[model samples]
Target: MKDLFDYCEFGDLKLNSRIVRTGLWESEREKTGNLTPEIYNRYENIAASGVGLIITELYSLYPRDVFSKYSNTTNYARFVREARDLTDLVHVYDVPIFAQLGMVQYSKKTEQNIAIDDVSIEDIRKIQTDMIMAAQKFDYGGFDGIQIGLGNYYFLSRFINPNFNSRKDRYGGSTLNRLKIVLEIIKVIKETTNLHINCRLNAFDGTTNGMTLTETIEVAKILEKYGADSLQITRPRSPQFFTRENKEKNPLIEASEQIIKNVNIPVILGGGATTQNQINEILNTTDIDYISMQRPFVADPSFLVDWQLEGNGETKCKTCNNCYWKKTSTCFINRSAKWDVKSEIPKKS
Candidate 1:
């Protein structure tokens, strides 16, 4: 029987459990883009909480991008130094952490939100260079890996999607051509850094000519062949699209199962699970060994500790998605309460 708490290997990193804590907004950080005490405290709680792996909130590549305000930017001067401290804290508990790097839009000095088809060869090179540089910083800061955002509505996601990328250049037309940009990025990162490269990808975009499960599986195989250490399969609009009402038939489960069969790298079923039983069921019933949760962690960073102790625990997250809409790290429903790490419970502030 596969258990959620079983220690296992994800790529070269060993984890305490099958639960992967994936993050989004970092609204708790300082306005100056420095990691605050609150940020460190939250991470400490999560690192100690029994999560198998930790993928940090999005590290926006460009400061002026659309999601930059809601994410942690790599442009901060103290990023590497402060990130080193944060990684050290997580390492104390032997939890491997990955820095989630992504940008919603690509912008140069004058051009803002450049379309995928409009991006020049020069722009592609710049984007790749920026991503490589970010990976280098992450390695220097002691991250176990880096989660490249090829999922969701990020620029790279659109660039690789047929519906969005209409360029006649080498970056468009066929799946391989569209994927060449990401493949090139992955190759350089693999060669340059020791950090594991985990790509977050959409199982299907649900668009007319966009990425379907068939194409995504093909993409997964190519990534595995070229060198992605692991993959987290998500939808275009993930946690928001996955609510209690639609819990019975999560499309990601089937999509992930298919993708896993085609690739040798670790595959994580990202989002839509809320309880220990749910996670364990997915683990035993499917080939997916790892499960990634985001909003539940936002609700309570230490929820996994309770799940392990109780053995049948479910998350307190209402899935209200205030965190998603408001773009904050702290849960709206539990905003008034503070996490009491000592008690492993939420207390009224």
Candidate 2:
């Protein structure tokens, strides 16, 4: 039987477990966009906690984008040096980490929040260039991979969705045309850096004319064909979509299984799961081998350690989402005591 703690292979990278930790907001950073000591401490605990892979909190492409205030920015002067230190720290635990790069809006000079279709060809090139530059920084900083934020409501997500992208140029209409922007970026990143490219994509946007499962399956295949190393299936409003009140079967599980069958690359089912048994059930029942979690780690970065020991562990995270809504890394409900970085060093088993 497949277990959550089983060591496995994700593409060329070997993992200690099947749990891939995906991060969102980062409120612990210094005002100047540099990584703080608290942030490093948190990551150290998580890295030593038995995660398979780590996708860092959103590294905003633009310093002034919508989610930038709640995220880390690559524009800081100390980025590479500090990032190198952070990557080196995680490497101590043998956890491969990826820098999550994304932006919610596109603004140039006076123009604010430009629509997907309104962006000029020059704008397109600039976006791609910025992404490529960010990938190079990740490479220079010793990162193992790059998680391109194509999921959620990020600009690139909307840029590829037919409902939001009504452009007349070569970048719109057909699925291949809509995906041309990302495909081109992937090709260049592959040539320029050794970083593995993992695209976090929407299984279905749940919109009238937006991305559906059928189209997402097609997108997954094209990404595999064009050079993406792996994919993580997510929805428009995730984690929220899978709430406590809703006892229905998760659509993402089925969606992820379908996407896995359609592509040759590694596929990760993002969000919704909260326990050891639940995760193992999904693993043994479906083709999905990897599962990603976020808030549970915020509640306790070392929760997986207990899960490994107890065998039937469930997260202490209330799923209150206060960490998400407040845009902080620390949990509001579960901060019983501050973690002592020096005294709490996790030893490998």
Candidate 3:
């Protein structure tokens, strides 16, 4: 029998399987972005559930604003310890982990005072240094790789987009001009340490005023040209960018198609792709080397593990995007909401 358990490699690291638990923003981290007992407990259970790679939430490297997405925040030491704890916990179960690294260039002057709109070239270099230091620490600890965020409101993406990155400096003019910082950051990480690099690209803005597929593809090509090991090109997501209707379609599939066609390196996709049939069709038709599941994994961390066993089982998700918590929290259709279930707890519980 063929190994339905597919295997793939990125740069120097070999992932045990191609199924990835997309770096999900569980919002369970400490207000300061530190690892919480809840977080370690959550992922420890997830690791045991059998997902090969657990790419953690989008983690801010800014020691101060590590918990920016949350209104309340924690201090620097607490954040680092929390990060270490999650990775430590994952290692015990022997699952490879990657930290999604990003910087905030959103807003003119947010509380942290480190917005991309205000970051100078020198400031960009210093931030790159901070990223390197952080990655080195993760490497020393036991992380498998570092995933780079570059699209939409991300600092690197801000610099990449002409609309957001309106500046006269070398870091923000033409395509090559804006890419100086990103290229520098990638070079620093590879030259300084041996950690695997995976570029998470915003391959399409899906809007009239933002980055087009052309711009994103051009950028992905550049990242590849510079020795980036792999690319995970997803569509323009986030309530901050697209509409509900656009979010409904599987933008990950389209972006993955564009990325696979442009780059020779391994590519991955993660978006509205939720079913076994959907994933299988994508793999058969496109060049995507991997399928990443975020919300589906959140809804049921063991979905892939179960798929491996049952080979096309029912998806627990209702395909509703209510999990996106801009204000309050709710789901499209959860156990408690159902009339049949008297009370709500995890089905597995």
| Top of the candidates by lDDT | 2
Using TM-score as the yardstick, the better of models 1 and 3 is: 1
Candidate number with the higher TM-score (2 or 3): 2
TM accuracy, model 2: 0.97
lDDT of each residue in 176-210, candidate 2, tens digit only = 99999999999999999999999999999988899
Residue 267 alpha-carbon offset, candidate 3, angstroms: 1.2
Candidate 1: segments with Cα more than 4 A from true spot: 342-349
Q: Which residue pairs collide in model 3, if any?
A: 32-74, 35-82, 105-116
Task: Write model 3 residue lDDT over 1-349, tens digit each, in one string.
Answer: 1132455565555555566776535466555445556566567766755555777776666544533563222235655555567678877755778877776543223545554567766667677787778777666656777888785456676667776776687777778777777788788888877777888878766555567888777888888888677777665454332333454666667767877788888777755555676667777776666777666655565555566556675457654555655321223455243121112212221
Model 3, 250: alpha-carbon shift in Å? 2.9
Evaluation by lDDT, superior candidate among 2 and 3:
2
Candidate 2 clashing pairs? none
**Which segments of candidate 2 are over 4 A away from where they belong?**
339-349
Could you tell which candidate, 1 or 2, scores higher by TM-score? 2
The per-residue C-alpha lDDT of model 3 at residue 165 equals: 70
- The global C-alpha lDDT for each of the candidates, from Candidate 1 onward, is 0.90, 0.92, 0.64
lDDT of 3: 0.64
Q: Give the Cα RMSD of candidate 1.
A: 3.2
